[model samples]
Target: MSKDLLTVSLDVYLGADPVLCEIVPNSSCGDVDSEDLEKQPKRSRKASVKSEDISRSSASSRARHDPVSVLVKGGVAVDPSLEEPLRSNAHVLSELDTVWHVMLNQTNISMNSNKFYLIQLLKSDTEDKYWVFIRWGRVGYRGQTSLTSYENKLEEAKKFFCDKFLAKTCNEWSNRSSFEAHPGKYAIVATKFEVPTKKEEVCKPEPEVLQVSRLDWRVQSLIGLITNLQKMEEDVLQLEYDASKFPLGNLTREQIEEGYRCLKDIENAINTKKFDAVFRDSVNRYYTCIPHDFGFRAPPLIKTQEDFKKELLLLETLKDIEVSYKVLRSARESKDNRAHVDRFYDKMHCQLHPLERDNDEFKVSMVSMYLSLGHGLTHMFSMEIVNVYSVYKEDEYRRFKGSIGNSMLLWHGSRVSNFYNILSHGLRIAPPEVPLTGYMFGKGVYFADVATKSGNYCHPSNGKCALLMLSEVALGESQVLYDANYTADKLEQGKNSTIGMGRKDGVRVPLGPLEDCGGDGGRYSLLYNEYIVYDVTQIRSRYVVEFNFRL
Candidate 1:
């Protein structure tokens, strides 16, 4: 294929609108300068490809090809010559019913493979027919496709679809809500869709709408944050790491392990006063294991402890990017690709309701405390509380408050990309395989009494937005610590939680009349008040606040 023609093919494969790239017949895709092509807009350049010329070239290039099936409107397969029937068929199936659609992803960092499989079942609107379409391949590529037709046999089609889903995911389709991932198998990826509802529109304003409009301005800000999923997705995508440097846009588990080991060695070297050859070798080893794309410029060496810490953080960020990229690829490959990220929340079974700015006493107290607590050491940066939202997870909340007491709302924050899994699975303890160097207080769900302390974990830089969650933590009987304790998870006999005593005080007033457990009676002095819970059931996510930090 010609250079220009190849670009067109890539564009089509990447889910660009084909209608915009109208191909002029009997024309050649002329050679264009590389520099000039780079300057031109992508849409403008796509129009230059000659469809007929490329089609003929592609046909001549292939050997022993199967019967070509062309997909037209309404996903109906037709012969190229019988184009007239497509219009009528599409019109008939305009309101086609979707029986089922699933997108699955399997990423084995150990094997360095990231792939996606999409299966869809659709029922004909005008006829007794069902279509089963399946597509599978490495992400960011067009991949292979198969279309099976079941004439007047909906049961057979459904069976075929379910069988395929089970074969790929090793999980029953009916029990997908409780999805379990098996070794060396695809995991069912959760996706959200905006299906049109058939409810008749009422002329009068909804009580909920009136209630929301009368909320306090601060509460309104919180409402805006929860409702604006589009903005949140954009912020998450902006938190990108360079994936193009890795093989198939995936970081292998081996690479991650090696990177962590290197960081640990450097940390030890710094403490032992061996920052010469030992530190240099560790730094070199890290760069070798984790390939970075520095282009023409020379890659910098990690010389100081601060630099070593930054590299360690980068390795962790890469892991998050790998996960977010796979989810994004699966969403893009599906038929209904609109608002894919926003729909992720629906798949996780987590609901976010905006707190009333005016009438909600809880919102008023929470916002007031959040703003007022911005004094002392935490008040260095200007804090803007963008939105406040009440989180509801039926199973977690119901199971959480069973025998727990002395609950107080505290702050938790994480990177935007991590929220995809964080909100889905709730906060999780680090597995045995993960490195312990990053977790100062060990593998547990950590929270903070001060917003800035938790907000720092969001890693906000360059004026980007970050997400923070306030959860009702049941810290019944806590063990106090001032220094790092790697084995903090091995709690003593009766302690329900661990409190890291900090130098600064949190909220002066009680956070919503909850029983206040004052700081460690000024016994130990740490930087900030850190709350760590070993059990996941001891926490109930209360509010998620999105805010921007201005330097």
Candidate 2:
């Protein structure tokens, strides 16, 4: 095997963000020459006479930008001296030839006048021209993107960045408040690749506080289940066995332990009852950040009665699955006879089978349950279904949010188009009315109906009209406000709008009569997207499914 020896170079901008005002790099110790400063046009006699006044004014301005700079003027070494690379040749030859290797000229700004801009220069032997790259982003996002530019000479390229640096400084001064409002909008420059050791060490919003309320019985119950889950995880980790043949066929005991650990973390989040924190923590375990292009935020957590209720339902389902696992684990641990174990396995398998068809999260949970139960029994009794079920289970877990970039990938397979199908099929029975809610896993246009109390009596036999026609813009499109008068033309106008307003992490769109559906007059013709059709009669019935969809 051979490794590519590609050189790389970075000009990073780091330090308090770009603020207007000129505090040129003070290379007083060495390196810069006096001729550099002297190579400038002389000021007029009038300007020269007022140089003292100008100096005082500039001092006042510098003090406003940085108080420490005021101390620096009084002979204190407040800022660290600029350090140069050991060799100039090494610096010039270090340009990375490959594209998108992470290291690019980036900048980080901190207090005490540490803000600066960098220009990356990459040498291309084949093209015989150096490639220029600069970091660009909005006022306050860590989402600095490396943009490519052309330059015939290195000095010109450096000058380009210097100019950009000045412009950015002025822009920063004008938009400092804007930058402060957006978290993780600045480009963070680091000396070397390092992992964050603390939560606040990284650029992110502070975690919201959790409050346990007795008014919500589900929260109380979830807290108890979380405590039990923690204990179970500890027990699983303490298990001593030869994991080399663990699961007896698929995952080692270590692998199973890892899954347990992930489950425990999620359970802890549930116990917090802090909706926002739970959603962020749960998704972050699997994704670095939500794609900015999607522009949609993770649904808000715990903002309304409906929001809490939905969370309660989700937690309840998770608790039920977890409890079922405990039963199977106990049976296996007791070394029950083959017949007894088989009975337990069959019973549990039937219970989990329906869940496998639910949303991605529920499906992943079912997989985890099967893996733990199957592996424990197989390790103890040399079972045979280990390979088959273990493979299926592992595959499902991989598709979940916690499993390494799984949430960002394109899922190419059958999608759950109907929300009602998931609830009815998952629970194994349909109720008179089940209030259901879930997140939008993939982007596309969807048609749904929200059951409302207004239509319960007026037209009893009219049936359910498609109250809201929802459309998820592009993959990178952000979720927008509810547009009651949204039309397919507006969608083409490049604005992302849904039929309903967001409720925490779910959507709640009001249902009104549609003219095309032959109900009382209301606008529904504009709801049509690419195609307009009148087929597919209204699905009216007593059993209605209330929707809470999050994009």
**Leading candidate by TM-score:** 1
TM-scores, all models, native as reference: 0.52, 0.19
Q: Pick the candidate with the highest lDDT.
A: 1
Residues 327-356, model 1: lDDT tens digits: 544643455433434333445577777666
Count of residue pairs whose backbone atoms collide, per candidate: 4, 27
User: Model 2: what TM-score?
Assistant: 0.19
lDDT of 2 by residue, 1-551 (tens): 01221111111111212233332222211211122122222322221111211110010011211111111111111111111111111111132221111211111111111112233444332233333334322111121223232324555544544444334333242233232212222221211112233323323224334333322232223223222322222222222111111111112223233323433444445556554544444433211111111111232323454543433333333323344444544544353334433434333322122122344455344333322232211112211111111111222233222311111111011111121122112212111122222212112223322112111211122221211112111222223333332232234333332333222121112212322233422433222212111111111111111112211
Instruction: Check candidate 1 and list the clashing pairs.
Output: 216-357, 216-358, 222-387, 222-388
For model 1, the superposed segments whose C-alpha errors exceed 4 Å read: 1-241, 247-258, 261-282, 293-305, 331-342, 359-361, 460-463, 508-525
**Candidate lDDT (C-alpha), each:** 0.54, 0.24
Query: Residue 293, candidate 1: how far off, in angstroms?
Result: 5.0
Model 1 vs. true fold: TM? 0.52
